[model samples]
Target: MIEEARIKKNLKQFTFPRLSGTDYEIKAYKKLTKEVENLNLKYKVQFFTFSSFYSRIYPKIGFSSVSIILFLFYLNIHMSISIILILILFTILIISIILTRKPEKIQFITKMDSQNVLVKIKSLSKEKKNYDRIALFISHLDSKGQRFTIKIRIRIFKLWITSSISLTATIISKNSILRGFELIFYIIGLFPLIFNLLSTIMMLLNTTDNSSDGAVDNASGIACNLELLNHYSIPENRLIIIYGFFLLELKNAEQWVLDIFIII
Candidate 1:
């Protein structure tokens, strides 16, 4: 039985801020293991490390690239030279993005250790070998905090994207109507550059921390997964269930787990 009281209790137990690589996160992982132990289920812990450099640097790269391309449009240089510069900038951006995705291939940042908890529940049926399917439930175990709220960040990002598109359209379009209105469009484009530049500066200023209670963001999710674990543990259930309490901030960790599952 998945009791609401038990679920709420679990939620309350996990509501505290527990940022990855921190002592509080270790405490939360301990509590999670204890809960699974109470159910008498065997589980495994998989540990891994990741760097935050890519997450922090990618947005700045995108913003700077856009700003520079827009600035190029106003320069009095030869058209061929301007095109060559833009192509070079784009090539650099593409390479940076590819390199950052595989951060281990480059060695410029600090790596932080984290772990994921995995539990496998066997099927009750004697014909389990015939059933090759497994059910997987996943919930992340880390909480993040930043200076700006998610809503504010989303709005700023939307505005930046929309303005960038508009500016690019104005710069490239050759329609007579648009050409007649080019002066107005250029003037309008300046505001977004200024505004988005400030937004980018604000984004750079914001730092990750551990201050939020994380009740809604992930405590509730963890609670629900616990309840599901309780429900699916019954001998009457026929399908195997795998519960994964992952550290999603580290994408490679999740991929490694999936690879293991595939090999199984």
Candidate 2:
């Protein structure tokens, strides 16, 4: 049955990391559209833009800051011990703020062709008065795979623990010296967040295929969608299934979704 086919197609669509603008994503969209059309369902193929998951800005910033800090530390100025301590304390505070300001990952979006994409989709159902709105099936189509070496993983974990401890110290320590140290720790903690953001940006710009077929990352998700369509009989209500391929390097999901709808 057509319903069965839709379910199968959904499965395929979700079987890979559907990074925005990737070949796999494009192909999957095309296949989904064709299947929907075959079922005599009126559908639209919307496009959107999102931040790339492999940006390099954050990492670059972290490394650059570290280098600068090291260079400054090496230039042993003739300051009194008290002055040196004060400087270190200030530096720690700055570092903490920087870390806290690091942007979030998974902040990409699809561009829709219209400012009122949601409205348009809603209209489709509204025009067919017989069709009631049933459920909104939302799923993201993307894949994330990190080829972290053992050394890198260990280093990352260590840094993460250190960052957490430093943050806790900052919160709990009342002594001015401890507070200063906490500030520095906070800044250092930000390095990882920045690095991640930069990597995400890079991913958006590159054609690198980091995933191995993205089977579990997303193919499984698509498969699940298809299965749902197949198993569930057509309801009197309209089904709104959203296949989203977002850039995972950004920080705002709601904003990204709004942007996608605007493009649609």
| Model number with the top TM-score | 1
Give residue 258's error in model 2 in angstroms.
Answer: 8.8
How far off is residue 35 in model 1, in Å? 1.1
Candidate 2: 10-residue stretch with minimal lDDT = 112-121
TM-score of 2: 0.46
Clashes of each: 0, 50
RMSDs, each prediction? 3.7, 9.6
Badly placed stretches (over 4 Å) of model 2 are: 1-18, 53-56, 59-134, 149-158, 163-209, 231-264
lDDT on C-alpha atoms for all candidate structures: 0.75, 0.43
Provide the global lDDT of candidate 2 against the true structure.
Answer: 0.43
Give lDDT for model 1. 0.75
Deviating ranges (above 4 Å) for candidate 1: 75-88, 100-107, 128-130, 173-185, 253-264
